[model samples]
Target: MITGASSGIGAAAARLFAAQGAAVVLMARREERLRALAAELTASGARALAVPGDVASEADAAHAVKVAVTEFGGLDCAFNNAGYATAGTPLHETDAAVYERTMDVNVRGVWNCMRHQIPAMVSRGGGSIVNTSSVAGTRATGASAAYVAAKHAVIGLTRAAAAEYGERGVRVNALVVGSTRTEMMEQVLRTAPELEDRFAADAIQKRMAAPVEVARAAAWLCGDGSSFVTGAAVPVDGGATAT
Candidate 1:
């Protein structure tokens, strides 16, 4: 299952996971785009289903997982990638609603998904779960303070879940994502055009990642290839956090 699967890294992961022969359940607020992607994948002979809903809603999260188990038989993997960010605004100037929304989608979304997904995964004997964090998860990164805090919570949640469930055969990990050329990043760049150069330069590769780059890491983590990796904040950041 993948949240935020309508676009950006989530969409890329949905396509990649489906092509790799995984049954995918996509959850997102955009019903039209989600169903369109699911139809495209289904036409290509992949097992894909669209479950449109906000990840931040506990009931919606439960419903998505239930649909995944019903349609696909069981849940073996999940990419909890839905997130929200508001940059360029100083903390003092940032509205409380912005902070709440940021935390709701980024932190609480992952929490809600995991709360429901873990049981199905445990019943299956084992599973892999990948949560999306950010370079801001560890550093300020000039993003809004709310975004930074929320991402930090994501990493914490990933580690705690990994510890609690590893013995039960469920592995949890997070991606320390860098500046990527995703729709979200485009919005950030639009609001703070001057930060583009800085964003690129922050990475050792001197460029933002493509959505597929991050998606590949997620696929690797979710598959058996990374069987021994759990609770890791694996970097898909082109060395942005390496220094």
Candidate 2:
């Protein structure tokens, strides 16, 4: 199961997981885009389903997992990747509504997902789950204060889940995602084009990551290859956190 599966790293991870022979349930708010991606993957011989809903809603999150188990038999992994990005204007300057909206999607969304997903995974004996955070998760990053706070909260949720379920075969981890060539990034650049270079220069790679690059990292964490890694924040960033 992949939230935010309509685009960016979520979309890329959906393709990679299907290619690797896992049935995928695509979850996001955009029904058209999710269904279109599902059709393309299904036509290519992979079992894929689209579940459209807001991740912030507990009932919706539960229903997405239900679809995965009912349609595909079981869900062995999940990428809780639905989130949005915005500039950190100043604490006082940030609109309260915008801040609340950010927290709803980025923080509460993950809370809703894990509460439902863990029970399903426990039922099947074990599974892997990944949450999306960002460089802002660890530092100020010039993003809005709310975004930074919400992301940091995600890491707390990831670690807490991992600790609670590690003995039960469930692995929970967070991706410290960096600036990537995502639609969100493009939107940010529209107002501040220099941010493109600023983001790249913050990383050792000196370039923005393609969404697929981050997707690959997420896939690895959810796969058996990272069997021993849990309760940790994995940096999919290009060494930005390293600096």
Candidate 3:
């Protein structure tokens, strides 16, 4: 199952997973987009189910998981990729609502999904979970303080959950993603055109990562190819964290 599967990294991951013969459950709040993608996958003779709902809501998260389990039989892997980014701003100048919204979706939403997904996976013996985190989780300048704080919490959650569930046969990991070319990043560039150069300059590769690049990393963590890897924050960041 993949959340935020309507676009960007989530959508790319869904397509790749489907192509590789995994029956995918796509979740996103955008019904039209989700349905369109699901149709495309179906046309290619791949199994796909689109569940439209906000990850921020506990009920929605639960429902999405239920749909996956019921429709696809059981979930072997989940990418809790739903998240949001508030406009970059200084801590003092940011609105409280913006901070709350960001945390609700980026942090608490993942927590909610895991609360349900872990049990579902446990019932089936074992599973892998990959949460979407960002370079902001480790660096200071990638996003606003609230976003950074929430991403840091995501990394913490990934580690704690990994340790707690590793013995129970669940593998939990995080992706320390770098700047990627997505609608969100494009919007940021439109609003603050200078950020493009700044982002490019920060990464050793001096360019934004393609969404498929991150999607490939996510697939690795979900598959038996990474059987022994867990509690890892694998960087798909083009050496941004190395510097």
Model 3 lDDT tens row, 147-242: 999999999999999999999899999999999998878877887887888888888999999999999999999999999999999999999999
Query: For candidate 3, which ten residues in a row score worst on lDDT?
Result: 81-90
Query: Which parts of model 2 are misplaced by more than 4 Å?
Result: none
Q: Which is the winner by lDDT between candidate 1 and candidate 3?
A: 1
Best by TM-score: 1
Deviation in angstroms for 42 in model 2?
0.3
Question: Which lDDT tens digits does candidate 1 get at residues 120-143?
Answer: 999999999999999999999999
Query: lDDT of each structure?
Result: 0.96, 0.92, 0.93
lDDT of 2: 0.92
Q: Write one digit per residue (lDDT tens) for candidate 2, span 138-213.
A: 9988777999999999999999999999999999999999989988788878867867778999899998899999
- lDDT preference between candidates 2 and 3, better one: 3
Find the candidate with the highest lDDT and give its number.
1
TM-score of 2: 0.98
TM-scores for the candidates: 0.99, 0.98, 0.98
Residue pairs of candidate 1 with colliding backbone atoms? none
- Which residue segments of model 3 deviate by more than 4 Å? none
Better of 1 and 2 by lDDT: 1
Candidate 3: clashing pairs of residues: none
